[model samples]
Target: MMRTFPFGTAALLMLFCSIVSGAWLGLHPAAQKQADLTFWTFTKIHYDPYTETIPTFEQQHHCKVDLQLVDTRAVTSRLQAAMLSDVDVPDLVEIPIDFAPAFFRGPLEHVGFIDLTQRIHQAGLWDKMVQARFAPYTSRGHIFGLPHDVHPVQLAYRSDIFAQEGVDVSKIKTWDDFIRIGRKLTIPNKRYMLELYDFRSAHLEACMFQRGGGYFDPQGHCIFDNDIGVQTMLWFVPLVAGPHKIAGSIGSGQILTQAVEDGYFLCLVCPDWRSKSIEKDIPRMAGKMKLMPLPAVTANSRHTSTWGGTMLGITRHCKNPDLAWQLALHLYLNKKELGKRYEGTNILPALRAAWSEPSFSQPRPYWCNQPIGALYAKLAPDVPFQYTSPFIATAKDKLGEALVACVQYYNANGDNGFEPFVRATLKEKADQVRALAARNPY
Candidate 1:
């Protein structure tokens, strides 16, 4: 049950004083003419709760919001062009946590984005907003963006199938053990364990972190080619050709939603925020699909990793950044307004308090009545700040090409080709980054 605080007769005077203090807070000057605030976003804004909730904000602020969908492909160059040309740049923009490092370089200076440094600190939520779980990502000891929502990886498996197969959940402990039992549960036609995409598999960062690999050290060099990287990659080879091979492994579609097209795979790996997508896209399986903690990797390790999610932010560019930040806060805190959206839309809240709400506490049977909140909280500690670089991004392109060369050795189950390609790519990136640093482009 949700708790409500009530004022007593004795405290009424105090309450009156508090209410007056709060009510007298900052009130902006009224605007007769319309003002437009341009917001650039990657997600189709209308589809996301943060996007849809803006109308209420616009109404309150008496402003018209023009939203644009910005694509990240060739993003730095596009941002550079906008900066250099002194042309159109959105008043407020969304950039993922991974790309924050690149912005730290200099592309952001010309944009006139209001430095939220002091404001966020004054709000006292600097840690919670920009420096939350992913603390390492904040550059130069200043917080920049606020989390949109977190979609940490979680387990999605068919309870009905597990029951019939007597695959005891407690028995599955490690990923290796997971593979072993998954191999046994391969009932030929019924269910063949779990499915996951070889590429974009949650394992990429999970294993990297699991084996003590940081995406970048203080020096900002990609070390994904180290032992942690090698071990992480090696873990996937078995799953690709193993006895309990995942669904659509032959082609594409290795995740829960992706495998939904065939319904051949009984289990899949997905993020906790997938409730909205699962319900809307796979309605037929409603009340049947179950959510569970990612099974353990080691007896000591937690099976969770951040995959995809975003946060809200007020760019330094906003003319009324204070009000903009307030609106951003309203979207997260206004229980009646934001709360309704979260419940109605099945979107997860990034705020810690939101989860304790009754609406969030209850379980949905379609997901096997999994203890969604409790399980997800455990994964929170492991979430890291994603790092990106011009060198790393360019290297990823080369890595994609390198995957083709690795394919032959991969097909032969040798695991030889990927390393050479990755090594060569990383060496070039390192050299390039070193030279760029020497030049000090900033």
Candidate 2:
């Protein structure tokens, strides 16, 4: 009944833009009415900083920034609409990893972003950026865009319950240990130790990443159906079905988001970004939240999966393209300003140098102020960045459908059981990705 990832759709983009029409007129359009620079950004304090940061650039080099604030989801459609209308385009824009590949074609390509591959290399942070870029955006042979920080989850379980259940998480290292802990703590009518919902894919993929399944291969092959992926999902999906009685079956849907916010559920595998979201939205679970590295595959193989965040990009369209580039790079690449934005906005910084700061390494007032960031910050260096395949988007939709069907199939026949549904669900979707990969050769 829920919608899937709509990668290419223009309608969804429009819907997103429409939602952000109010609560601001933060632009300095009046001051820079004659400005030659135009930078388009999504609605966020992090993006807005570029606008404010430009005065320093302006003071130094006499130029004005004409920044257009937009919602992230609306970026693609607005650009597409601009092309069809042949309207003026901004000089700089922040396209998240999901929409970057689509912009690789058309007007963007014609008057496209200043490819900073050389500049990045010149800055000498290319290798460090490359190390973190996979979590932020998928890159190709040529580094496409700058990386923001990665959003990785730590297992935040109820410590009180763990103590009550005699579960020592420090000793419980494997996936099996996690299950045993989850099962022992699940007190049916009293509490659900784990809430596997529609959004459970985030957790599932995290597990898959621990087992070495990634979004794509360096050669861009589809490996979702690889044995590691199957086994990882098999470990949790069945446990959530019934006997284990994990929270009622909800995949990552809107309802589940609300449910988690309400504290209806106790434990969740949450990303760092959620720290801010929960503090604001779910005040009930504030101090109780505790962190753990994602439960490991071989215990000591602490490698974990991370969901990526946003990055900055310069559009090839401005009247002063080079000026735009300087400002974009200055704001994103600056360590001091990046740290300010990182701590204040709950937005992490992309500058690799920023991580070495005492601020990042130390425990915090928020997030239990644990030194967890330093530990979970090491992203897999070789994640496949070439996400340009046309079928990747479709596969996301189909995968959502497959997840939904599993829920329906199990709910209908929980007795006859999971093998029938699991086999039918995974193989069909997995084969589609494999076949698509073969044809496109990603």
Candidate 3:
């Protein structure tokens, strides 16, 4: 026995109820109209670029993007948790090369990431992006991420020290030459020709990569005990051991800063990103550093190696994959935005077209007035394709342990046993990784 309202009265009552519900829920008209997107990244260095483009994109797409900056470790932990819980997941995330392979190793449909293969091909981005940057993010037959930068490895030497030591860069073209010059620069206890941070064997790996060797082949098989790898280990063993130590380990943080500032290292193996950090950390060493192509394994090696990079990926939780892809493209694929990112962060653009910018040609006084960008540009195209499997991160740890152990053995025994020991250790580690890969899915 309810009283029925007239047509106009009922319509007015319904509208009033809608307004009340909206107000109660704290949902304004503008808020309801905007599509919200969440982006998680490890660095706020990307904020400026996002600030520039996101607003424009929001206006055009009627979407609001919220960027969350988190710690590197936190990014992976949170991403994994969110995926597991299926709640509070970001629409986009930045994955590094070292961690990307693990994610990409699984089937694309089963992983938390979206497959970007068709979109990349259709947008013509496949040809425009740095080809080598795609390696770590490709799995099975699908590409899962868009490359954010090219991290070509280079040798940054103290120019003043090299000149003082009569170590001519032009003549030291091969690894043998580099080692000879390094031996000459060694002064027993006070200083060494190079420095090693107590991190992973990035320096050694960079050398191995330049020699066309890596932890695994493109087919995801371990090849670290191959001829090239054996040769690399043989060379690395002596440099870190005995009375003829050309490289000394400097633990990270303030000690590393102090070492670099105190001029304990004549040369440092640097990636493009590392070059930026040197300028930021050891400002006192300004104008003393210089960039050179990596010392080749052979006199005629045509390629260089790369280290450390990031890739922008869309998560499976994205409500609008199309828009998320658009945002990623705006941030990284657009030449203008790429140029801005480079200017702001010294992030070497993965887009080949962006390399022609005038800044790439400009000389910087920070590195003895070297055209750093141009040199990196030349090296970028030649960076060899490096592949990693899911076991890569653990494999790196094992390899580092082997490296430390080899150095300790030599330092203790003073015997010519390091090469054989390193070879055996590398083989053992390779077997471990292979067995792990076989047992693990994908």
Candidate 4:
């Protein structure tokens, strides 16, 4: 071949092979490669809805999607490690509200999430979405994620219990009224008006946020020990402790459902998602439960607070951010999917336009035929902003510790000097948070 092979013959054979390969490829287009996108989420509830739309998305974009359900506790740490190591990073991820601040710890330019400010504004989403929802995902005027829900919190009460006791929930408009009426209804450890925990800060945090106080200000500075905080603690400590206690502790999951079945607590802090969970977990209690606005500190105070939330964000390492953004929109803003989600999860959409979904107006038999979606939607505008910081988790832990100390002090010394002790304890915690912030300085 080296001595006698002709270049023209070799060239002709190569051309024929190329033509055959082209013809084969034309006949079997399915063999062509597609751009692959990897997505990670923490729960099946968050993952299942996409099953309806992913096929359409793949077909339209000519891409493949690989959705992975990761454990909530492990997802954030794994994401951080993958991003830091620059290997096996997902193109899209769902970040829980509690875990969001962890990704925002470093300098703005170095944040793991891609800056989405320009894109959101360009797409007109900045105005189309609920404005308050952006507070948790924004950093230095840059937005990193799109909100997944409004999560407005309301008070879900056992109407049957209230009616049996001849109590009218309508007359109770303030926290003071709630406590006073609760005192008459509560029967020591046998039954309680509501649930709170001296060892946890969730209920306390919700109440504080309702009162326009939270762990951090808009500037990401710690303000957990502010005047409102002290006053909230002073009012809250007696509800779960002391001689005038009107609350009990009912842990979450099946324990919570069982407690409701046994009538352990008459009222629960019902965020929109919690309502759906209750409906699914104990379907028989549908007619017994009803929704009402959270009792306010003042007549003008906001009637609702936000609880749990999640957001969809694109990673900086994503090879195709434009595609990821499109996918996020497909999942989050599609009215049909949003309506379906509302029907299934009772989670209000953050997009204002989606509020008009017929599902929002339909009376849900699960909530005693109350238009629960409309109820949550009515208070959606008033839900408080949840500002975030890298120190927020730490602040929450410290707040829980302060709550415990205050409860113990009240138990030992009574309400005679409870206010001052609460103030001092909150001040110490605030100082501790400030010290940590000073060291980190983000």
Each model's TM-score, in the order given? 0.74, 0.78, 0.88, 0.91
* Candidate 3 structure quality by residue, lDDT tens digits, 23-142: 987754445324478998887777656777778778888888988787888888788889889988899999777877776655657888998999999988889988888877777767
For candidate 2, the lDDT comes to: 0.59
lDDT values of the candidates?
0.57, 0.59, 0.80, 0.88
- Give the number of the best model, judged by TM-score: 4
Off by over 4 Å in 2: 1-33, 48-52, 105-112, 130-140, 160-166, 247-263, 369-391, 409-424, 430-442
TM-score computed on alpha carbons, candidate 3: 0.88
TM-score of model 2 (CA atoms): 0.78
Please rank every candidate by TM-score, starting with the best: 4, 3, 2, 1
**lDDT: the better of candidates 1 and 2:** 2
- Off by more than 4 A, model 4: 1-35
Error of 4 at 245 (Å): 0.8
Judged by TM-score relative to the true structure, which candidate is superior, 3 or 4? 4
Give a tens-digit lDDT track for model 1, residues 1-442: 1123365655776787888877766354444434467666665432466566788888888877776676755444565566566566556666654554455565445323455567667766645532433343344444456666655666677666677778787777677777777777665555556665444434455445545554555455655555665555556544544334543243432344555544567676667656566666676776567766566557877666656555455555467776667766776666555445656555555665565566665666666676555566556655545544434444344433333333334666564555665456445544554565555454
Q: What TM-score does structure 1 among the candidates reach?
A: 0.74
CA lDDT, candidate 4, residue 275: 90
Please give, for residues 9-125, the per-residue lDDT of candidate 2 as tens digits: 577776666665532444323353577677777756555666566777788878766677888878878876775676766666777655665554433245345566776778676
